[model samples]
Target: MTATARLALTATLCAFAAPALAQEITINSFGGAYEEAHRKCVIDPFTAETGAKVNIVTAYSADAFAQLRAQKDAPQYDVIHFSGGQEIVGASEGLLLPVTEEMVPSLADLYDFAKAGVANGEGPAYQIAAVGLVVAADKVPSEPTKWADLMKPEYAEHLVLTNITNGYGMIGLLMLNQIAGGSGDDIQPGLDAVSQLLDAGAVVVSTSPEIQAEFAQNDAWIAPYASDYAFTLKKAGLDVKFIQGEEGTPASFITANLVAGRDNVELASKFIDKSLSPDAQACFSEALRYTPTNSKTVLTDEVAADVVYGADAAKGLMRFDPRVIEANRSAWTEAFAKTIAR
Candidate 1:
């Protein structure tokens, strides 16, 4: 061969022998313990099994949704996780793609409620956190049975009421409203109840960490919070016990969504599918005390005791429509502030 032709042939052969770059997908996760659990449960396992590189952006639900909106035309994250119901608005605004059985094979294995949002172009709920009461067992003489127990005069000064601004607080308020004869449209009864609690000296808080602080340092005897967080308090060395109200425990559904206008839709679908798998679901359940949404996820008796496991167990959980909450959220926030102020 001529010298120039020989050089061209050698370069072409080297190019052909090179391996393709690994597929990469960016995703958002809530920070702190939840992020740690997600890395161990879903992200690490997905990467190991699929050989895809996963990049994590640490942002909570509201911030994550805001980021999605800011990047709607050119999405940066392939998948986004929402603990609140921001997916409803995201899907409506064309920022998220619909989750279908065709996109994710594991969709068929999830509980009916978990798949309820699929028709609305929203993602399926991968995990559920039940909103109930957490009590300092050593401080309270007797166990409380329902949502109304927080109003007991004996436990008046020792209460921690979560504000509606928080996701868990919103669900907690809804549960309180339900038991107090208030519906999504009519929150007066719940407002009246909260006013009474405030008058009785209940301390209102806006975040999980504040609730934990109250239990640990401020001698808070009872608070309406999530089941997962109750375990968190326990792990922190507090004598806390989570109780499902007799009326019903309101639940927060954590969903994983595919970002619209992304180049890695197929890879994102695989990540979502992996999150819904039995092993991943079980890992999350064991690590965070979050209830698994996949029907096939099996938990040990010890872990199951803390979670709302199985279809029959999940059926008893109270679920408010995210659309209703989204619609009334602004007015409800204002009313909640005013109620607590009085």
Candidate 2:
């Protein structure tokens, strides 16, 4: 073909592609400085690649879901990123789409435990991530080898907790119970341990950064730090360390579910796959300090030590089963509220 013929054909293709690229998808995610890191590393790069604009609106999952429910007739977003617990509850209420490995090819990179177990079963549990104890080298005694150490009287007045009401905190409770003879399938022993911690006088903070800052400011010496928080502290030159704990560590999965009233199921699936890719997982793991669910991707020595998903570290982590939690959340929360009020 002539050069002019080639130019005309290319021009025609570009004109046809412009409309699809013009459509921007909005993603609603949980708020925190960590969300900023995700936006920088994940959302923005995705936008730059596909010419699909990504608007990252940060809101707590519970509040966002309430808003979504109210706006059911006119849904505002295409994708929602939230806690594994919330995703399970949302799936039960008929609010989410079941994800398959076919949809997210990156699923193959995850560990067997991360993929096939109770956490990421045939359809329910979507993604896996961790939350563990953050201790200052100067303050905590020997990196608190186990969850039971948090309740030790020596650290009583110095501990900063990040929301016992949250799922991560609940997992911490479960880990304590595991140390005290409780299993994930049976969180009662864990709940009992939480009650004990409260009685021992643990200070509950509003956010993960607050927990990190309190420790860094020397206002408090130790806390149940989010994995992200601990990484940030270490980067800032703080004498900080994360302990996966001998009894076990606590972790929660982040899930992406198909929203109702959307026609882009295939696109959503593609997006999920991209997010779980080794490259993307590496980006999140290194940049955001999250342990990637993709088991094939290796971390740096320091990060591997920090990741609860690593083989050795995995042994120390209490399994997260969202389906079980979904079945009994209300009852557990009610019981927890009652205990807290006392």
Candidate 3:
């Protein structure tokens, strides 16, 4: 065809492509600084790379699950991000799609355990948040040296806890319970331990900002929380200390789940792939202080030294089986709510 004919054909194709290109994929992400890091490190670059518009919707993991169940027949979100093992329950109920090496080739690039979503058979593990205890140096008379330190006479009523409905809250329960000689099947010991604190007036906080606020006012002395949040609290100028827990910390990973029936599978898959990519992983680790699951994303010595990094470091952390946690989470939450009701 002549040059003018070729130009006319290209223009027609471009006109037809406009609508599809204009299509947007919605993602439910964690709000606050985590969301900001995701927007900067993952969403922004993905948009710049593919010209795809991504809309970010924020919800806590449990709330996101509830929303998914309510919108089951007519789903609203394209990709759902979850911490802890909510993905397992979502996957079993067919609310989420499977994420395997095929969906994200970078699956091979992540740690072996990270390849599976908390062993829950859900989507890919994009990032990991190490759950542990954070102590307020100024409030506590002495440094908290172990997980059992919260139950000590000096720290009663000063403990800040995340509630059961939240992911960190669940992890805190499991960690303390395990330290008190309980397993995933029994969170009673954990509850009993924290119940003492609650009885003495320990504060229960559901969000990172809430934890920080409670600490800033010297109302809370210590909290069982993620390592990232400890750094976040410190950076915000709280005189705090992050304890690695004499009994190690639990790993509550953030996973990327595809909505069971979404129109933008290709786009969504691309976004997930990019989220686990080296660049995005590094950005999240450095900026948000999350533990990177992508093995290929090497961190500088300085950054790695401060946070959980590498296969050895990650393995050193504690992990609850997602299936076990899934089975007992509902019951545990009810018991925990009652324990802290005082």
Candidate 4:
């Protein structure tokens, strides 16, 4: 071969080998179906495409955050999937990287709310999580149409309350507070509302899956749960439904964030982009029933109701401002802890 041809062939060979030389990325994610979904839709595809290994670490966000915090000076994972509020907290505390659009092209696939609100700011990088209330449709009389109705007499004993320490639990209480004629400014009444429910014999559940299983077995009826768990029960043929509660239940969101300090930033960006693509969005909605931020994704008619940010419910959805929650977290947790003491 001529010198020029030999040089061109060598360049192509190096280009092909570059991705394999890219660094591997480790991600700590919440376990259960989310982990499985990530495996099927993200990690596998990414590794297959680039020949780079992706290790997913499964654990609770709280535990993962604590671990990550401990390793702040020398971070272990190259990407972290955490709650949007937690992401904000980490970013504020200097535990996370401020992701840029250059790292995650998927930012363009996200919806306006997902992009601008809590997750991806304007340009790109992290993604906002989607969350909502999960309830069984048959147990209650009025369908539990709105966030306010959960406080009614019919739902009094039938409802299951999540452990108060969880952020989403506080969101549920905040919704109740708003329904009970209080604003975020005054959440005491919301606490009072939950107090009345507890007094009325509502069950308190510690995990989302447990709450879901109880609902499926008819041991419990309603639950304020994440959208993903809601879909899990529904798939098992339970008579459950997820309503975008009136006044809207707080959407506990997380930004799909990548650790910028990694050597695999390019590959990490590719994985992020593919996961947020329309095809992946549809897969996520159909499999987990979690709403996808990609506007182009479609869902089955049955599932369409449960997807929080689907075409029908996107316009009226309400989400708790994470900043607000973080600001008042201490006071809120203290009040909730007081309720637990009672």
Best candidate per TM-score, number?
1
TM-scores for every candidate against the unseen true structure: 0.90, 0.76, 0.80, 0.82
Error of 1 at 326 (Å): 2.9
User: Model 4 off-target regions past 4 Å?
Assistant: 1-19, 93-103, 117-133, 213-219, 327-330, 340-342
Pick the lDDT winner: 1
The better-scoring model by TM-score among 2 and 4 is 4
CA error at residue 282 for candidate 3, angstroms: 1.6
RMSDs, each prediction? 3.5, 5.8, 4.6, 4.7
Question: Clashing pairs in model 2?
Answer: none
Give one digit per residue, the lDDT tens place, for model 1 in 1-342: 999999999999877753223278999998888999999999999989988899999998889988889988888899999978888898888888887888899999998988887777688899999888898999987889888888899888899999999888888788778888999889888888888888998899988889999998998999998889989988899998888888877898899998889878888999999999999999998998998999999999989887788888788787888889988999999999988875
1-342 per-residue lDDT for model 4 (tens digits): 999999999999999987666757788877877778777766787778777787878866677778778888777777777664566666666665544456666666667666563342212322233445566776656676767777778777788887656666776777778878887689888888878899987877667667766786645767877776676787778877777666654665555655535677666667667777777767766767766677777677876776665556666656777678777888888887787565
Candidates in descending TM-score order: 1, 4, 3, 2
Residue range 271-338, candidate 3, lDDT tens digits: 88999898899999889678888888888875675478887777767678877877777788788778
For each candidate, the alpha-carbon lDDT, in order, equals 0.88, 0.66, 0.80, 0.68
lDDT of 3: 0.80
After superposing candidate 1 on the true structure, give the runs of residues whose Cα lies further than 4 Å from its correct spot: 1-22
As a TM-score, model 3 comes out at 0.80
Which of candidates 3 and 4 is the stronger one according to lDDT?
A: 3
Question: Candidate 4: TM-score?
Answer: 0.82
For 242-334, candidate 2 gives per-residue lDDT tens digits of: 766665566776656666666566666666666766677666777767777666666777666665655565655446576666666777767
For residue 125, give model 3's deviation from the true position in Å: 1.2
